[model samples]
Target: MTDLKFGGYQGDKSVHTRGGRVLAEALAKETDGALTLAFDESIVSRGHKAADLLSMTESGELDGCYFSSSYLAKRVPELGLFDQHFAVPDRRRAYVLLDGTLGYRLREEVAKATGYEVLGYWDNGLRHITSAVSIKSLADCDGLKLRTLANEDHQRVFRALGFDPQAIDVRDLPEAVKTGRVDAQENPLTNTLNFGIHETHRHILLTRHLLGVALVLFNAERLATLDPDQRAGLQRAVDHATQAQRRFAEGDDAICSTELTAQGVEITELDADTRAAFVAAAKPEVEITRQNFSAELRDLFDKELSAA
Candidate 1:
């Protein structure tokens, strides 16, 4: 049995469980119960946290996990570089860049640096502003208490945009919003609904602020030890699971739009004028993100993805 341990909020049925379960079941069925899974449920659980899980999987303590890309920013700024401010529109466009240019380079980097194997790619889609108030433009962001991942760049971007960002653990956000400690926050549809944010927010402004991607990684050494047949079986399971991940994320995007609106949330798209201002505010930050990208890799990436 392939032992797999993943991290996510216990109740989260979005990407972590949604995608992880597909792989777990596939492996188990393929191995005829000779494989097993052990999912690690922890919040404050970020992508960088998976490094140890990958190591342990190599050492036989675990198998693999659905690791977040945002959390890796602290250790290797380049990993989180793509998540920098500004919007990428939708998941489809985001994937073209992520799975295209960024995804290829990132996997090579992680494998070389951390001995982790990137199993598959799954982009969770763009983030939106869900709040107690209607936020139509950049001007509306001023003076609002916004919730964000307690990461250096995330807080910096929101503060630069003129919002007073409260760097609290995400588990406390709903309570924080309920108590009026924060008026608005940013998160993707998959996570927002998984966390039940719709119950407390009245509006969800369509601001493709940031996109999230989870990298399913495995311990490199362990993967290498598998016989050719087992390795093929594993890759086959992941290939099938990749399609499941795409389906789950895309389906939930539609579900989130409908569910939140049905629950009385005001869902509106930002007008052209507001969108322009918002893009202007986020441009320099995003440029900085692009500039910080590895110079040599960026050129290769640009050339490779353009071909793809």
Candidate 2:
């Protein structure tokens, strides 16, 4: 039994922290306190940003972490497909894809690349664009300086939709918006409220863009040192915690929308035609993204997209 340090970028109130708590509780209950866990909030002791946590985990600096898939996509380009605007129809489809062979392939690739075990994926939910001005149509996104993840495909996809995308880290988003360095940004409803993105800018367009995924990963080498029963307990803990996190994210959309509106944030849900316009504008980029994906990833993407 070692002192295991687990952490993520979000504060204690976030689903990330809740998920950590859930895992910790599960481990304790299942393993009988065989492993001790110290959950670090906002990477306070790790001294690394969320995006870099996976690498830190691999290097054994941090035993494990929870972070956005989009940030991890920089290391695994195949993951960028999920970041493509409208790539996933809904959260259900996203889960189907992530729980199937596609998810297994991604886990394998990530493990190989970073030496970390892809334990589970929790929902980040659908992302939407929010700005200083209301965005009612695709044209509204044009020429706007939008903040996007450092992933190249994110920048490319936004560019295809006529946005001037700046690759900014999520931690730096508030400052970017406050300083007027970027006029708009996109994230899940829960993320907007959790990070106070709604406070700086009042306009929120319910684009339901990317249904993002946040991965839970652990150091494979470190995990190997665990006893057999401890390993089983850890797996069970991840599964239980991931399910809880997904439930929180799915339920947050409505609650967060209500809170944002109560805070005077102008929220707009795009109509059929408006959504179609965005899809049309971004279609070429989607196709290009598909082309860029490896054959294995493309096959899986085609399967998921073609499924009823």
Candidate 3:
């Protein structure tokens, strides 16, 4: 009978928002009308940023939140393993790795490190580079000042690729691009359009370099207070919501190129050799990540991903 507050930073049209709605609706049905839930889209309205959401959950001001795993990796370095470039090439393989043993183990590790339980991993889709300049080959990236996530793994990969990377908050990225503070940045197509980065950056490459996941996390302590039936119902709601969001993400990827092109953004589909070159440039960072993070989990991730 307790009311649950779920918060998301994504706007109304985003899958993150849709997923939260699905979770709340399913939880209501599964709990047989015993639970009340309130959903807030863009907690930034309350002066809460994405990074602050985790701390808010830990302090019990927020019951749950959804954000990129890389944001969480900032606090728990081991989670950075997922941020490695070209880690999951396609959508199908991404599900294999995340829904399999590797993801379960990593979730446990994350839970121990942070006081949040991973309910599910929602697909953020594959991230591609968007720049003020067209990138037709690997050479085009030279000396580019790219905006990137503040996560070390992301910055390290961009640095290795012969570009200068500046970490900028998503909220500030539009001005960052307009002011020439950064020449380029990377994100999923949906994010580029949603955040209005596509308007400022005309050239978008289909590098498909990184696949990101938005983790739906609930405070472990809060979840533990639910009765067994309620807990099971809540978990099921997350699973169902995740599946729906994944479908939305996949569809968005298919539609984005046409949409961006219509808006005057030049879209380049990377040739196989060009993509391979960027991958090779980024490969060295993987070993560094493994060495610096949880080797056991990274090794298992490699073993499982390779097998698939």
Candidate 4:
């Protein structure tokens, strides 16, 4: 029997870790104990940055991990498609595209580019802005120091929306929020609450600016060493985990929102005009970024987006 290692940045209660647990059980069952999984629920607790997971997996320090697609965008430019603000209207539409042709092509591209096999797309939730002060209009964002992922496309979109965006790794985010290092930060409500950002930032702006996705990745070389049955069983395990993770992610938003409200955090839902203004303000940046994508990728994105 072989035991493979999987790592995650989030705490054990997070959907990412929960999914990892599910994958471990399913893989053992599918492989009939020929293959097993050992999950490290919070690698961040082991003094590693969340962004470090990518290189760790690629270098085979970790056999597998689930990480945000934004971090991989710089290396795999095709992934920048997911970094576009407001491009995916909601989680349902986003999943349709991800589970379809666009996702398959990107998986191939990612494997070719980075030598990591893409196993599944796990929901990272719809990102929203949480601030020390309420953000009601575009003007409210001007000069605001915002914490964002280390993705240039995301930085550009936030900059166009009038925010002064800074890249901060997920490991350092809670202290950054507590110490007022940034005036605002964006994440799903689950993260805001889980990471304790909601405790310090009293206001939650339902920007829903981006629907985040975490790609389940396995080291390709390690996968290639597996027997055919083991490889097929691994894929089946990933499929089971993906379905459960999506359901957990979908339910988390509502639960997190209610918990935030009970904690006296103010939740702001933007009116139509306000939301439209944000989309319009960020449009030029989105268009410019889209131009950098390959014609093939752009065509695929357009087709999948329309069909979704």
Which candidate gets the maximum lDDT versus the true structure?
A: 4
Root-mean-square deviation (CA) per prediction? 3.6, 1.8, 1.5, 0.8
Query: What lDDT tens digits, residue by residue, belong to model 2 across residues 1-308?
Result: 66788878876667778888888888787778888678877763345556667677879988998877887776787877687777688788788888888888989888876778888988877888989888887888889999987777778888988899998867777778888899999887877888888888789988887888888888999989988988888888888998888887777788998899899999988899998888888888877777767997888777886782
Residue pairs in candidate 4 whose N, alpha carbon or C atoms collide under 3 angstroms = none
Pick by TM-score: which candidate is best?
4
Q: In candidate 1, which residue pairs get closer than 3 Å at backbone N, Cα or C atoms, i.e. clash? A: 1-34, 1-35, 2-35, 5-38, 6-40
Point out the higher-scoring one by TM-score: 3 or 4: 4
Instruction: Score residue 202 of candidate 4 by CA lDDT.
Output: 98
Descending-TM-score candidate ranking: 4, 3, 2, 1
Candidate 3 matches the true fold with a TM-score of 0.95
lDDT of each: 0.70, 0.82, 0.84, 0.92
**Residue range with the least summed lDDT across 10 consecutive positions in model 4:** 11-20
Answer with 2 or 4, whichever has the higher TM-score.
4
- State TM-scores per candidate: 0.84, 0.94, 0.95, 0.98
lDDT of 3 by residue, 80-169 (tens): 767878767677887888899988987898887889999899998789999998888888889999999878888888888988999887
lDDT of 1 by residue, 215-303 (tens): 77787877887777777777677767777888887788888888877878788898888878877877776666666568876565456
